[model samples]
Target: MKIVDLGDFTVDTQARRLYRQSEELAAEPKVIEVLCYFIQHADRFVSLQELHQQVWQGRVVTDTAVRRTISKLRTLLGDNDTEQPKYIRSQMKRGYQLVCPALPGEEPAVQSHAAVETNAAKKNKLIQSHWLKQLVAGSVVSALVLVVAFVLLASPVHLHTDYLQVELDIPGQKASLALSPDGHYQAFVGRVNSGDKWQLYLHNRQKGQLAKVSTPVPHVRFVDFVANGAAMAYVGFRQNVAELYIQPVADLAAKPQQYVLPGLSILAGPLALPNNQMLIAGGESYNGNIHYYQLDISTGQYSQFSF
Candidate 1:
């Protein structure tokens, strides 16, 4: 069987199996095929079209599908798109290439008759020694378990009842708090001074750096970070009317997109949805009473839900 040797893994061409230090890795067949193709063309960059033609055998597949396959292969190979890839590297606007060296397969050595007999004798001795080692290892493990149990029983466990307290030095009172999905940054509405209005501010949990996210606004009722942590949505009041705005977290100076719900005063919400949609709860005066409505961000349409 032809076996190509990668630094940390070996690929069996005939069996179509990948092994890491003699341990078999559970990878999909397509992933292995992709890996083999990369290894075959390890010398240069393999374009996306070449991968589709050779690895997929000219099957009708979307670019997204190919990218997903590459992502899965990267995960299996212990690589990532964020970090500097060790095995597979992506060529910008092109395709991917195997960065690591994969040596060609070598033929197995032939054994002489006397050498074969000697190997058989050594194998039997190894089997006997293996049993003895197992017994010793079991005894050692049992003793270790007993010692650990005794130590755990003898040691008095102290309950930790201390709560972590974080203090932020702010010039004014803080309002709503919105933590990022990754728990790295926190966005909150805070007033700079007693007479000033509430504005959006961001706090870095790791660095303890606080910065203003928005300019001085009248009031920020609600704030929420997007799922991707790239942007945030907030409901702010202007001239006694509530409006929804979305701002990028990285560049707070950029103009935010404003979504105005005519005749409806937003009481709460601006919740983010998948694909740039937002859910809002507000009320509009109709007839003689205020009727609650749910507004869709995409179409700017509202439907009456409650009174």
Candidate 2:
């Protein structure tokens, strides 16, 4: 479809553009998908899970991603999730609705340029006043931020600081933890507290499920999830040799694909990157050099850079 009318704005679907009269507005493809989907279900509620499954096409994305798309669409429509929402009606955990889905052949009545300018001038004055208030608020916020940072660093955790910490009862957990790209699962290294070597455990926060994900090689130290969130990469040391391992989060029963990382006595990271690549930070310290490497999971090859 070329043009979609939605009250005050016109959306050009094929062009991936949004316009308010003659002024064209930037809209990303994903944002447009969200907007058009709302129009298709105009005045009806669409759940977040529905948007994730239908709009996102069952792709692996976090709830945060869906909310961000809604925010972007609302911005384009001159609306907000709270305070000054004009076009989209959002109900907490219920869904979203298009408030004014304009019927075909209906357009906003043209206003005289003089009248428009008069309104703009009034808005400009109000905006100037709003900005002055914001300037004062910004300074207060900066001071509060500094105080919060000092308290977090110098003192222990407290509700008076406005941050909550929840400790999950997983298997014997240690320090290193990795949250999946989708923010649904967390992987931590722990043991059974029965004189067992440390390995990896995956926890699904949404489902409240936990599982052990250990490779054939023991003593896993560092772990990270792949970009797609269905798989993970980790580093383990066995017999004074450090090896890199990649395995699927859905299934750890099968042996993980492992690669021998030569020359590095100590390994720290397997940072996820795009196109099945990750960053490995470790080098032969005894050789008087520590380095970071780009490891290709598909080919099991590592490339180092200078400086």
Candidate 3:
């Protein structure tokens, strides 16, 4: 399935569903299906014949039917093609087009069985699996990203220098470490060499000296502290490509909980905010550039970071 996020609304082109935050916008099933077709072929202007072939599978339908379905999709997304056309664009004689910009490795929010009463209060969970599949299906191509970007958010709160300190391990080959808001613990990467082979080491603050911890993946290009310092978000590199992995910091001797976020070719840090939640940057290297996203620990929900 393919997923696209346009700030407030998330469109899953594969499933033909529109979600506002975490709640699914109620609409006719046919309308949702039509919207999906436009999103799948976002850049191309989908003609009536193409739309019918993809969405309806050669089903008979009038021009009025297509227009009405497109209209409903716009309304559900709080958009009007005539005014604020964020999602879809219409033509006089041609079919519709997707105007919203899609990010590489970006996922759309999927509404679960649960519903939220207010759109403002609901937090959308960006589903990555569906979006990744769609991109690969569209084009069998990939690219290489040379630079790794790091961004930190500013807040009114200040950390006591004594409680937390950051440094690069010797050569600083991997990403830097970050402390939680409370400052009870810290997380950083340790380096180890096995004769021509180099790897990142996972280290945490224990009783006294730093101890070695086994991560979800051994060799990684990036690592970040998450879950208020209870977990570490690390990325593994193979063939110059990276994928994200989440592991716990509780017991270094014990195995950590691992979560595989597919389609993520590169991941950037445990960027902690005032609320204590962490942000990680990730993307599909071959498809496009990277984008910043926030991850919720309690729910494991991810959303794109707005300026």
Candidate 4:
């Protein structure tokens, strides 16, 4: 079995496994394929189109799926940090490249499927063993907590009946809702159904009509109006990476320009500021811990708030 040494971890190409020291990290099949492709083309930028052709085997797949796979690989490889992705580096508006050097090692004598299966079984057993120990150790405390929770839930509770409710006919769950500075249009991200992807939509209060914004990607996380409601700025996700985009509101058919923000994974609450700048909240971490940032809409430059 051929092994590729990836600094902190090793990739067993024959077995299709990634290992950090003695621990085997579980990664999806597609993620593994993507990682291997990056390693094979480590010298240059691998464009999204190339990835779609090679990784997905020329099959039609949404850009979101590729991005999601990359995200999963980043998490598994401990390259989740936006400021410095140790393994894979994303080139804005281009493709991704493997920053880490992978060296080939001597092939193992045993390359049979049974051997690979045995190794995978051993790794799973190790994981289950560790989980069993933790479960046993926490059983007593968990039992006590469950008892308390049950008692609290069983107690008679008074419910408030006096409450005012007003419902508006809006499609999907509204997220990152923002009103235009001129109060003419309301922009928000919405997913029509459970299986549908979130998309950006504009609600015109004057006309009482909803219009869909032409997003390049399937997922639109945040949106806000710029240029005095003549233009719109939004954070869009493609292949699990967040990018800033600006488009003319008058002509939604016009293609939007994508902006590269190196370390931001999730962006939210985009507020337009003076002088073609924006105030936004986003983060590099997966836990949704975010910080305020000021972005120059024209230049795509950003600086994080300190305090």
Best by lDDT: 4
Clash pairs, model 2 backbone? none
Clashes of each: 0, 0, 4, 3
RMSD of each: 21.8, 20.8, 17.5, 16.5
lDDT tens digits by residue: candidate 4, 47-152? 8889999989899998877887787687667575667878898978888999988998644344466766887687457546745865985897899888767766
| Candidates' C-alpha lDDT | 0.69, 0.73, 0.58, 0.75
| Best of the two (2, 4) by lDDT | 4
Can you write out model 2's per-residue Cα lDDT over 1-307, one digit (the tens) per residue?
A: 4577777788665566666774555455888888878877885899999899888999999997788778657655656336556788888878988887645533334456787778668645654674576598788999999987888788755537335556477546475788887889999888778587888888889988888775777788889898578788888878756778888887778778876554456677777766787777776554556766666677665545223
Model 1 scores what on Cα lDDT?
A: 0.69
Candidate 4, residue 229: CA error in Å? 2.2
The lDDT, on a scale of 0 to 1, for candidate 3 is 0.58
Worst 10-residue lDDT window for candidate 3 reads 143-152
Instruction: Please give the range of 10 consecutive residues that has the lowest summed lDDT in model 1.
Output: 284-293
Question: How would you encode candidate 3's per-residue C-alpha lDDT over 1-307 as one tens digit per residue?
Answer: 4766765677677666666655566566888877766656777888877777787788898866666667656656556436657777778667778788654324544444343423423422222442455477445433212111111124324423465455433553334554544555555554544332234454434443455455545455556666656666666666666656666666666665444334455665545443446567776565677777665555444555532
Error of 1 at 208 (Å): 2.1
- Model 1, span 50-162: residue lDDT tens: 87899899899987777777866775665644357778988687778888888865433335567766866864575467457659978999998997677667873742325
TM-score of 1: 0.41
Q: In candidate 3, which residue pairs clash? A: 1-130, 142-286, 143-286, 190-201
Higher-TM-score candidate of 1 and 3: 3
